[model samples]
Target: MDYAFAGAMSGLVAGIIVCPLDVVKVRLQNQPPISLTNYNGTFPTLVRIAKEEGLKGLFSGLSPTILSYLCDRMLWFATYESFKVAISNHTTRKLDDPFVHSGSALLSSVVCVVGITPLWVIRTRMMTQNTETIYYYRSVSHAFKSIIKKEGLTSLYRGLIPSFLGIAHPLIQFPLYERFKIVISNYEHHSKLEDYNPNKRPELSNLGILTSSIVSKFIAAVITYPHEVIRTRLQTQTAPLNKNFSNNTSVIPNIVPYNGIVKTVKNMVVEEGWKSLYKGLPTNLIRTIPSAGISLWTYEMILNNMKNI
Candidate 1:
């Protein structure tokens, strides 16, 4: 419950603040690799979206984004702690064991990806579409219904495979964060566990945590970025538009949808070059790394205060 509250509340704050960047990132990602005029650069894309679609377009998926972060962070933090405890108990190792942390993060990632993938699919659809697009979702529920009705029930889980593979992001991130935080906490107070307190704020540890979170999230996002591009492409791919995919082709018609993570990677690389896998990496990193750091920092800050209260 403590972790849940911290994760959800902090995620809400972070999500709202960083949603505009996310909107641009998803747009960049959903576009074809060789676009001359669409979603060009981070700043350009932001201006383009705002100019063409207004603030509503800039914050296109805010509602679903908030819901996704709430469910994602809440489940992730809670499940991570539970998995860490269970894994630690099963092993003959302490809670701070790197192995335990990585394993716990991996398991928790699985839970989160499976639990809230549909929300993400809906969110992606909402983010990518605009008023001029073929199907702009009226609302979150409307998006859900349109997808399930027009595409089918299974379409709600469109990017499940790449999402599963994207677990590598947290598999590396959370463990590194845990290890870094412990190191910083110990170094700050001159003892391994003395500065570590649930019911009190650690002295002089906020900056260290911020640094650790930024570094960890940056590395993880870069390493696991291709899966993100693949996932977005998969989620944005809809069923055939009236028995002929070519005739009434959408804006990004040049992008051929491919299924299976490895096959998609192969096809993308073979057809569009290796850069295709990193289409929106700049915007993604700019948006998500800071957002992730903020969420982590906020989570720790809030959790400590909650415990103290």
Candidate 2:
């Protein structure tokens, strides 16, 4: 019942529940035309992919998704908790220290972002690959192997630019989540009876859990969206590998260089139009809010249960 363990389980469960939507989002982002004509909704997308590509198509890249999240949740919760503890040790404030809480949350998010961005790159590629080659991966390991063989070692880290920039998820997400949690917890405390002790409160009601999650994640997604756009583009770019392929520098395109982060951003806006920046906003929002909400709810619920025991 450790909060960390619970959080991981919750995340895994949430990932499975929403993965189809994730596949849809990734495809939408990667495809140039950005068409939804083949599918009606998340469920419809799943059905259509199944009919056309079989069951494997629907669950393509699921293995990497699971592995990525397992690591992500552990680093996320542990780092946030440890950071908060470390800060409290240095400060004179009590448990309600807003600065300590928000700061810890922010730091934790960055740690997770840096650690998991590589896995995210692989996962995204695995999901968005053409349907014909969808079954190429049997699992996360298979996906990694295939990518390395075909795209080289750097392929595993295709999205590092935008992913690193997305370190803002923690800066933007955790503080808002903490604030929302505080608000909900405060409301519950005041509404209860004089003899009521929230310290011994039973498992959070499903409604409360869902409510806290939606509000926190929605706010965080809205704030951190633009960064999400940049990260996706950088991760999914088709720039040639940096390594020496047959020692031919001429093979690389000198006209459209993919060097430097700012240059990439400028290129995207200037060449591809401003709308290109927001390519995956719809899918990003659909994926982020629920993914974040379930993660937070599961963490809190598990943490509270363990503490009570």
Candidate 3:
């Protein structure tokens, strides 16, 4: 019934459904510009991962992925709902107003991004870890311990800036969703007046909600995709090898520092061209649309059911 609980449940379901796609996306995004290993595309990458590493590979980092999203979505919805209520109390506008919803979504996303950045860093590192590479993480705990011990606490927040930029995603998505809801509701009301069918109204609302979720997610993902690439690069950038671990012999090459978001974008464009900023975007869309739609549907369903109870 609680917003946080509803969000966490919805996120857990969405994360599980989208984990395989996410693993593929992360692998594709984390690839070096001029690497020996590169996936041809989403299907080929999926096949390769499955053939080489089996199902486990497809679900790599599922634990941390779900955990990160669970917490992230919980914080996001809880904060957004709380902010919406607080703002509505002060403002003349209705709580459901698109501007208020958008503002709440943006602020909530910023807060959640800060809180969940480390978990996301861990999830990305774990997902992108190639066993063939010298550095391999055994588990979520192993990844966290290794990263903290080797890279310091700040490493966990490596992509915080770009992630903050990611607030633009929900800012756009929730506003569009609210606007779409209003438009769809108005259209459905007109249709019902002509047809005078009460039974169909709920169905129309449900369809509108799902459609809005999918459309908003797609648009937001495309516009904000470049930030995703930057965030992945920042998070996956490895620390310089420790001299003490020199004898270990199985050290993966360190990732070149990405500097800051601006420098990183410039460097990527120089080395790999502007298209590089949208690497894995296709896969990202495929994953995000359904994931977001399902999440919104689930969240709304749960909230409604809880309200009835």
Model 3: lowest-lDDT 10 consecutive positions: 193-202
Q: Which is the leading candidate under lDDT?
A: 3
Candidate 1 structure lDDT:
0.82
lDDT of each: 0.82, 0.64, 0.83
lDDT of 2: 0.64
* CA RMSD per model (angstroms): 3.2, 5.0, 3.6
My TM-score estimates for the predictions, one after another, are: 0.91, 0.79, 0.92
* Predicted structure 2, TM vs. truth: 0.79
Predicted candidate 3 versus true structure: per-residue lDDT over 1-309, tens digit per residue: 289999999899999999999999999887877676678799899999999889999999999999998998899989998888777778866666777888799789889988998899989988987665766777778877777887778888988999989889999998887666666766777753334332221334678779978998888889888999999998888767776574222246534558899998988888888998999999999999999999998988888788779
Name the top TM-score candidate: 3
- Which of candidates 1 and 2 reaches a greater TM-score? 1
lDDT of 2 by residue, 217-270 (tens): 776676666666565555555445445344321122223344557876687678
The stretch of ten residues in a row with the least summed lDDT in candidate 2 is: 247-256
